[model samples]
Target: MDKVFIKDLEIETIIGIFGWEREVKQIVRISLEMSFDISKAGKSDLIEDALDYKKIGKSIVNLVENSSFFLVEKMAEEIAKLVLKNKQIKDILLKVEKPGALRGSKSVGVNIFRKQ
Candidate 1:
């Protein structure tokens, strides 16, 4: 399947199990790889024939910014569900990362793959 990817999308939100975490917004880096067919768009060179990634990104930002989730796992699942709402999407690979979450690590996070 043809793939469309969005990388290093950073957003601030309330996410974590700690009391302080809930009280403050933290930055989370999200990346997504979507399985889609690009043949029609490539052939016609028209945006109307292609998947609208900007719209998808905006929707994800809205969802994450308004949510207060304790785990990246749940966040990822929710994101997958939202993206999968588009019947044209065959599946998605999503990654949600919290930078500086661990003392010594650059980041900690979850990677999930979901199919429509």
Candidate 2:
């Protein structure tokens, strides 16, 4: 299968187990690789024949911004579920990270893969 990817999509949301975390919005970076067949779009050169990545990204933005979750694991799972809702997507590799969440690390997060 071919792939479409979105990288470093940053969104602010309430995410963490800490009391202060729930009080303020924190930035989470999301990246994803979606399995798709792009031959038709490549050959036809038409929007109708292609996976609408912009639409998908907007939807993910909406979902994440409106959600309050304590773990990046849940965020990743939810993103995978949302992406897999499109029948065209056979599989998804999702990563959700919180930058500067740890003292010694650049970021901390979870990565998950799911298939339909």
Residue pairs in steric clash, candidate 1?
none
Q: What TM-score, computed on C-alpha atoms, does each candidate reach?
A: 0.99, 0.98
Predicted candidate 2, C-alpha RMSD: 0.6
Query: lDDT values of the candidates?
Result: 0.97, 0.94
Name the TM-score of candidate 2. Answer: 0.98
Candidate 2 local lDDT, 1-116, one digit each (tens)? 89999999999999999999999999999999999999999999999999999999999999999999999999889889988999989999888999999999999998888999
Candidate 1: residue 106 lDDT (0-100): 92
Clashes found in each candidate (C-alpha, N, C closer than 3 A): 0, 0
Q: Which residue pairs show backbone clashes in model 2?
A: none
**Model 2 bad stretches (over 4 Å):** none
Span of 10 residues, lowest total lDDT, candidate 1: 3-12
